[model samples]
Target: MSILYLVKKNDELISHCKCEESLVGDPGQLDCPWCGCGWLFSCTKCRKAFTFAEAKEIDKTWEELAREDLLGYSGKEPELEDINSWIDCMQNMVSHIEAGKTYIYLDGCFIPADEENFEFEGWKSKHNFYKTPQVIALKDKDIIDEVLSNPQYWEENIIQEQ
Candidate 1:
């Protein structure tokens, strides 16, 4: 489902933007249609939009945490520290996306999480399918506008190679 939010300046609605709830949940950020500046995502603590620099830092932290979680120990059962680090990394990544500092592009059609079978069936056989991640240049204001105008463009243009 898509929701339109009015962009206001001086208490007047200048323009509006559409957000896909499935892609970005509530409290997620979307680029304003009138102005290129992003106004949707903000830090819960500071209420300020996340910068690219902050996103990079968080990404580095997440990588470090993931390394520690995966490679630091040689034990069968995961240690509390390992699990905690993984959780922290996930939280940081989510927060970074929520702040609109980074965007995730899935190179495939959307599949509802509730669906039981995600694989594709062909010739009496089932094949596992995974959505590939593509890096997008969110710095381009025009790209943002285009994406907002037509959310399906991404899926149509970029299809995952089987």
Candidate 2:
């Protein structure tokens, strides 16, 4: 019950160990049994070693199995959903808000709240990685001037106003 490793370059091609000799001894070992080669990861033709990130692992035992890259945020945060809902509420309020009324922008979200007393009330609040969101009045003259002058802000979802 030995597991064979292979690299598929294309639909028609598959590569195996270039040791040219049959794997010797027991199935589970760090080094290739036949050649006593510890570097099973070395490229056969080019002889270059691959880092873990560059190489793909295939389990021949389960040929149909799929691989997934589990990186970045999965959006499972409950607080994020609530925050988004609050953002939506604020977006809806924008149309009815008074012409001179001010709004607070906090960490990519806009809400009609007192900037000085505003806090993101959630489990994320206590985490050190989560910085206390800087409060900025969306109607500030300086902010308006900067946003108008800067092209970078135009490309980002800075203001998700409907």
List where candidate 2 sits over 4 angstroms from the true fold.
Answer: 1-96, 112-114, 121-162
Of the candidates shown, which would achieve the greatest TM-score relative to the real structure? Answer: 1
Q: Model 1: which residue pairs collide?
A: 29-41
lDDT tens digits, residue span 71-132, model 1: 42332455667657555644543542322233321211122222333454322122343421
The list of candidate 1 runs beyond 4 A from truth reads 1-41, 46-51, 55-140, 157-162
TM-score of 1: 0.23
Worst 10 residues of 1 by lDDT: 5-14
As a whole number from 0 to 100, the lDDT of residue 54 in candidate 2 is 16
Clash statistics: count for each candidate: 1, 0
Residue 122 in candidate 1, Cα distance off native in Å? 25
